[model samples]
Target: MNNTTHLPVNPYLPAPLALPLSLVPGKTYSQVMARLLNKLFGPELADGELDFLEGKIMRVDVVDAKLHFSITLSQGVLAAADTKCPHDLSIEGSIYDFLLLATRREDADTLFFNRRLRLGGDTELGLYVKNFLDALELDDRIGPFLQMMNGATTLIGRIPRLAIPKLPFPKLGRRS
Candidate 1:
């Protein structure tokens, strides 16, 4: 008997791209995320604005994409955690929701309130991270690329979310 299942169509990665994406090494995920995050939050790192993350593990779970990335801050530098170790905090959500949050299309509070994003682990750490995300500002110095990406994300959000069959999505290893 066929065991294929269906899930909402993803406007972000699509079924084809999702497969290969999942095969990427965990180290690569860490490297890419660390580089991008460091670039985006360099000032905060230098100014010690993110010192609270020192020796802390923050895991981001992109459910639809079947990807998990763990990051840590040490000596004011952001790097990827090299193992499948436990996390001090975890932020789980779909790619679309993450895009919305990052693009300022939706605030972190609203997403958590609406249950689109789930926050787990140390409450104190979670609250601090949540506040940080909510307070993120897209200034001109950060440039207009995010604005353009936001437009694209908004358009992608409009795509019908009806279930797509035979998507080959892996079983979600939800945390208890």
Candidate 2:
């Protein structure tokens, strides 16, 4: 028999956002994710925290979105592939789970233990990548952007389901 303690379901937890997979072109998704990753890792590389990733490729697979991309640190620059590429390690998880990790709503150990996230490929490289992310201080690196993203996520979670449109639409209001 399994002896693992299952986490209790929380009533207050927000339902996962439904992605308009059909509407978003595959190329667009890849470009957007790549840009985001580059932005995220740029400062880390500049600070030398990601020196361990030099010459190594790490792939992140968003299972639900059917999206995967690889990133490598070379010559002190972090570059993300526009499409799938050979990787030394891969991390797979749902977008929601990844977002939770990024926003600090969940820890890597808890997610990994619960099987919400999985790692594969080179074990040593994977462990190194995991440890790097675990030790990252997002606030020190991308404080304003991280804070804004977290705030947006929290605001979306608080909105009533009935108030949200079934289809997402661009707000044509004044731009901030």
Which residues of candidate 1, in runs, are more than 4 Å off? 1-13, 164-176
lDDT of 2 at 141: 71
User: Which residue segments of model 2 deviate by more than 4 Å?
Assistant: 1-35, 82-84, 140-144, 151-176
Question: What tens-digit string does per-residue lDDT give for candidate 1 at 36-69?
Answer: 9899988778888788999999998887777888
lDDT of 2 by residue, 58-171 (tens): 777777556666767767766664444567778987665677788888888888888788988898887777798888776777778788768754664455434455987787
Q: What TM-score, over all chains together, does every model reach?
A: 0.80, 0.65
Write down the RMSD of all candidates, one decimal each.
10.0, 11.6
Clashing pairs in 2: none
**Would you list the C-alpha lDDT of every candidate in the order shown?**
0.81, 0.69
